[model samples]
Target: MKTPFALAAMTALLLPAALPARSAADPVFTAAAMRAHVEFLADDLLQGRDTGSEGHEIAARYVASQFDGLGLKPAGDAGGWLQRIAFQQTERTNIPAVLTLTGPAGDKSWTHGTDVIVGLNPDEPKVDLSAPLVFVGYGIENARMGLNDYAGLDVKGKIVVTLRGYPKGLPSEEGAHLSATKAKVAEAHGAVGMLSVATLQSMKARPWARMLTFANEPDFTWVDTDGQAHVDAPGIRAAASVNEPVVAALFAGAPQSIAAIRKQADKPGGKPRGFALKGSARIQVESVGKRVASPNVVGILPGSDPVLQREYVVLSAHLDHIGISEAKPDDKPDTDRINNGALDNAAGIATLLEVARAMALSPEKPRRSIIFLASTGEEKGLLGADYFARHPAVPVRQIVGNVDLDMPLLLYPFTDVIAFGANHSTLGPIVANAVAPMTIKLSPDPMPQEGIFVRSDHYMFVKQGVPAVFLATGFANGGEKAWGDFLGGAYHHPGDDMNQKIDWNAGARFAEANYRITRALADSDAAPLWYQADFFGDTFAPNAKKAAH
Candidate 1:
């Protein structure tokens, strides 16, 4: 167990008299009731709470019960506390996947699990297609950014050879979003498939061998009411990432050399132009899948104000984790294989529960209604939260703001916090004021290149035109080293159990910070609005009211 910070007593500042006082030996974490929640949720018996598993169902029931005990109204389906979601989980069936390129020189082929690896296709069980190839730099088409890789190119009824990542030197979050959804642009142009050849930079980050290992992981997408799986660009029949050899072949005898394209992509503000290649590509793969179901626990705390009560501020935390590893006789007898995910997010859920308790016990009710959500399938590409955002328990337009709690590192005393996406909306000052009284500062995004803004549950809400922020303990005071150490070792591993060094006082402080932020959003006179002319605001909610930056 890690020792509490020197200023551990400051935990009492959280909710400021929300819970009973605790002795010096027993801190506010226990008094605030997070310790019990964390211990139970992160216990070995929960089996890591894998999405759609029995363990996860148990975890969901526990969260529902906690909400029920708080006297909160059920906000889920059919007057119940569970918003059930169906998913289509898929994995490759070890078929001999193959990709062929026919060019001026000759026909060249590469087998999967080696020079190429195809991603799982949730829409098709088996795919066989051949289409002409076109090289599109970064495959990003955004008119607002004044840089469209497909500006002068037509990929209709053909396969497009694209770079793996976004161009250099765009706004980190906006660039990341454009790059991530590049497939949709390809579909819009009637492209039949995507042929992604990694840049030298991307290959350095994820080498061929490492990419091969990750390619084996299963893929998931939520199912619609019609029993069809969701795909961002369903029109794109297939996509495959190729290595150096395939990249060379894709650009052979082209107007622009691959080496020059690589050089341009290696530097800042690289914009390699797109062109038609000499040849066509054929892609083939087989996918095996099964239908699975999970639930998002939803509870409503009614607002006191008659008018504002119709509006809502959502507080969400993901409850599922990576599952356990299979036991092998070759494994060491002392080896513990369960990935309990104590900090990977059992801690976040615990904090959410405590925040709920603090709100329920507080004498004053919020002006706007509050929804406390324990979402499942977050580890599976934010599936649960995405489902909820698209199909909310309440009207999606009624959600004015969202504060998502994901992976708060309670390893050290954080002197500051980071609210991702705060700068894009009026929520910035609200977050700032909430933590100021606790002697905590608000910091800017320290690692912008990681594109963390679009990688959490709140991003799902943001896409639905809701102003949202993902709150996490910042890298300050011993937090930098603590974050690095945990990420390098325990993150997503068996070492993330309760056995690790977890400072309860830090957890309490983190919970309090989120509580204050939620209370402020719910009580504020005006709903959170995107800053004027913001990219996300214009793109997602173009006609909505906006705030001055």
Candidate 2:
């Protein structure tokens, strides 16, 4: 929270009647409004709103029109409401992927889709190998942590099958999770292809739901490490690993138990052993890739005062989801397709839209320009937000603050709104003062380890020296299990629908709270400052004006 320099200035200058009386304890979040907006955005008519698709274009136009109706001006090039982003939508083509293994008994072949699942690998999909299969344990190569799965192994261009996650007894005190990191290390070691043996439930063939909406774009190209282009390779089929007793094998001495192998792999003498199988192994796969375009929508409600108007405040929310999912046994009866990202972001968008409307209705305009951004491709690695941060529509340095609205399924009784990056700026006091009347708790960041502060669209602003705030309903709901259940299950999957039960009144109340805060900041006279020790302070330090040139 930035210091209340603007609030103080406003109080000093305004006559009592001239200023809008701060409403007393108005609930800003409303379940009804949230549901209405979500129902519109996530309805079957939207078709999951995949990026760069016709449905996505419809969504963008609708949102832009809404902003225009709220009296917000175009913040994009040529005074357009949409911030057009050039994106490469890719689709996979028919690519041959084959795996063959020669063992004592004979040779075996595995077809794609049936044998393995693959991450996006570049073109030149042919991966032919006859190398020995070595169990690289957990596939991690972190020497600084005293764990190196690739130790004492020559895995160059060979098949390196390993377990996911880090080695046992490895401390997680650091932010490092070895799963994704280890995969990169394996790739660096010249492993032609990597495989993670499923230990939890053996593989079950996951039902193919519709591909994520973003996957539909034809401009989407699949790339490998070598940057070669390839079409869709077969997807890895989910299957269960079984012991020889569950299968008739050609009489082998291979390790039959996953537990035994895991235990052995942890031992000091358990260097990954390369082995020749008594029988051959075979793999086959089939898949497709397409390319498309999506954008991060931006509009500015410029401030009234000339000097102060140079500074900006930002409000943002992601407008994308995991696209639609295919039906599974766990799917609900009414809705069998489309992962309607209701609470995931449709609700957040509603909050954003409502705030913009309320601001426009207020008699007094904000001192600093207010930027309302609706970003696309958040589910696809935060690409839209990332691009905006790199190429901002406004001068990035002129932006003083950001507020990102993420999740709000239910409001608690006397619940506190947790603000991530609470210590990063002086805006804390201002936020507190605005919400204090309503008795809303203005708590410090709740889960820094979850990295929520750095996960959303506001994160892109924060990275660019802008003090940003991300607010969400309490995960615990004043320590209730029901809220936790809603978070764990419906967060990103298909079940996050509109009729999932929500406190609409609470939502409206919270929305009102946000409205007051945004207005207060906008009507203020001074720029919000980064906290003294905050990371962004150095970039906008008081003395850096001379050096900025």
Candidate 3:
């Protein structure tokens, strides 16, 4: 039996041949061209392209200039290529915030960062919290999952200590929703403070040292039209992430052992229970805030069809990366301090630029307009993308689809690509068709446990009911070990610089696939639509109109 994907690929191949042939003189993606872009953007002179920093502004200007050189129309604020994103930055003071637990074994003080990492609510810069501690398994209140960690507990004015993640067996989206809303759920239940303990899974993914590396990094939130920073779980006065030993201390006199509770939480289909602890907690933190501006570079390529031109297909990539790290003595004598973010995202932006240039120079124009967006503050929790989604230059409804390029690790030769969120919408078949002629297999996410679908800039579009897909080089043709080595060694480290091994041809192939995907979305008669029974569709776009067939 021919699968729907196979049928779609056959139709795509036939239709492309029927359309007017593109000129041979049209600009094609080349490894050298892509390398030029990546090299410039990822250069150490850019100082890691930190959001709102001078280096980031320079990078933004470079992208804008590239758009101008390619003759793309400015599609950002005030007819400029830059859409300035207003942000509120919150920085914690260097003074150690304190966490003291008074239990059966007597009171114990935990040092900040060493014992627990504490952060005060931005709304309340200085908070002195003295409240009873309650153990709420995961602190989740998800009715859809038929589990409420706080259902039987009255946590009014108490500090809720919860595990980091959702239940083991729930669907990823469901778990993600529950986990994301845990803080708000706790606040709604009258909790005054929150203390999060890393789960076994989280601990394995990131060690304490890696987690503490960013302890001093500023937290950013998009400023609203009213100029107020967006706040989540407003009433929570204090929050802290405690180490494993601290978790043990918090449960010293509890009815059940912390080990037993963690065991239950780790088990499949396990539901850890909530209970009150025998003691109280004292939490304190101090923070300050400042307003800053970042730019999201946007440009538009008008389509040939007047009617279809009103609709748009968006190609997005984040342009920001973690900035220079403080100089520290390491075992490696030649360790680079700047996190150039070559593979983390400079590669993605380079690919976006190449795609834009190719589309601009192509003789055959797409039917729908294509928007090229190089967003900022993605490393700071997708702030720029979220802001743009909320306040778009065009109506959000007019965005037909999004193809996001982020961290396509071109570390080795690759025969396949992974398209996250491919299963959720018509975009699935479109992507299949796009990659079919390239002789590249579209593989499923090998690491579903990462919950990557909601972790990138495309997720902001998905939340706005736009059908979107995020592309990454897949683990095939000996790419798995390459990927593992990259993540384990250079993912966010200074080693992510251009000096690291990069397959330029692989990058060119990545850009080519993206270009094909974008062209298909822009030229297709029908817009992308969420699959009828998709969880995201049901939850986010229940009333979304179907695309014309």
Candidate 4:
């Protein structure tokens, strides 16, 4: 007997044929067209379209040309198709950045990549610090939740060591924000430096090797109007992720062991207490900074309704990917060297283009304008999207919602999609309504532990109070295993190129689902709204209208 999921998969598999055929009036999103876009963007000639690279510029122009050909109006910086984002790229110098510990036992120096990974401070050419260490639990301080990890602990002029995650009970969004901005919190608490240690679960999810793979990759910050990179609140002089072993070593003379702390942090409602460690840390950092310009391609489709046309819905996909690997396999010289981010993002951009084309060529226009944004610097901490969100081509308040197309792993006959950030706003029901006609299942996030909601380009919009959802192929019809295999093998590798197998039909279906969602948002009488009393709404956009039933 086939399971319910299997039956759903079968039903979905039969959908393409059973659905009405596309006519000249309604443009069909074809796999061949999407593949064409992907092939060009992910070509080796584009050198993986790294942010601020020449290949990236070429890809930006190509997207602009496609948007122009589709008859979409240019909506970017200074009445152009490209929004230039200023970035300050910083790299760590070869000069050995060191972390030394001093205790009753003796002084010991830990290796950079092995026992610790230090983040380069671009503002400071060198950071030399020697301060007492304080264990600050998960390093989260949320006043809304009445949770302050720094409470009862004074870290002034001290090096605060903390775990990576927040308590399990806090809302995912709240916890994610706290965890992400812990560095700033530490700075506010008058800490001179910070040392982060991963829990067992975090280590297993992202191994140290994977974390160190891009150690040399340049870190970027959006440049301010004064032509200066935005700086954090003053106080933190140095920060690094210390190895678990190093963490255990730091607690050598303490009453509680590092293992005990990890055990407590893993439990529900668990709050590890902060304590002063016997040891003090000395950290040294050296950095080199350079500036570059990256362009985000933008195009706008006007709406039929004059009033609704003033409101805009955004469709976004990142155009950048990790470029060529610095470390090449000497034995496999014949192998491809470029990290052609096919599914990582080229597929996403292709999907965006197809959707834009469909909307532009349709006989009926949406009620609200749709903005297609192909962003850059997503690989560099979502910088492009951040800049756009901060300085939008359209009035920021007029932006209604965002539908982000990132890596939709279309390796199998997917029957469902995982829409990150769907639950927070009316966009959830909108997405359900959009996909109901197509008979596609909408799944909750399968791997919430990875924090998929806040990691992508859509997050920038979300931060600015715009409701957003990022669609990805979900765990159905062997998609779980296929997605895992892709991540384990080809993700960010040279193998993520055209050589990998692709299910064109799946790609087409993915695009179709996104187009429907975008159309629904654009045509809806009421704009997308945050759920009343939602954490994100209360925190980011308290004045946002409540969703209409």
Clash pairs for candidate 4: none
> On a 0 to 100 scale, what is the lDDT of residue 131 in model 3?
97
TM-score between candidate 2 and the true structure: 0.65
TM-score of each: 0.93, 0.65, 0.92, 0.94
**lDDT (Cα, tens digit) per residue for candidate 3, span 1-549:** 667998888998899889868669545678898899989999999999999899999999999999999999998889999999888888888767899998888888886778688875657777789999999998887665688888789899999999887889887755775688787999899999999987777788777887787777777888888987887888788888888778888988789988888888888877889999989999977888888999999999998999999999999999999888877765476666889999889999999999998899888888999999999999999889998888887899999899899999988889999999988888988998988988998998788777888899999999899999899999999889988898889988889988887999999999999988998999898998987766787678989965432
lDDT of all predictions, in order shown?
0.89, 0.61, 0.88, 0.87
Report the C-alpha displacement of residue 189, candidate 4, in angstroms: 1.5
lDDT agreement of model 4 with the native: 0.87
Compute the lDDT for candidate 1.
0.89
TM-score of 1: 0.93
Q: Higher-TM-score candidate among 3 and 4?
A: 4
User: Which residue window of length 10 is worst by lDDT in model 1?
Assistant: 23-32
Clashes of each: 0, 76, 0, 0
Model 2 alpha-carbon miss at residue 295, Å: 3.3
For residue 392, what is the lDDT in candidate 2? 74
- Cα lDDT tens digits, model 2, 1-549, are 665998978877777878767564333445576657777887767766766666677778878988888888888656798776655443345674454555654565443334433334323223333445555666766555556777677766555666544443443212233453555676677665555564332222112122223232333332332433323222222111222222223124565445566565555434343332244334333334344556667888888888888888888888776666666687668865777777777778888888887777667677788989888877765667767776777778787788888766553543667677656676666677778877777876554334465566676676577766777665444624645677667766667776676666766766777787787777776566676534344543443221111
Per-residue lDDT over 1-549 for candidate 4, one digit per residue giving the tens place of the 0 to 100 score: 656998899988999899878666756878899899999999999998998999999999999999999999998878889998888888878887889988867788886787789887767877888999999988888777877888888899999998887876666656777788888999989998999988766787777888887666667888877887876644677888987668767888987888888898888777888899998999987888999999999999999998999999999999998887764557476667799999989999999999998999899998999999999999888888988998888888999999999998978879888889898899998998898888898899898777788889888898899999898989988988998899889998899988889887889989999999999999999998998877777778988787643
TM-score of 4: 0.94
Error of 3 at 211 (Å): 2.1
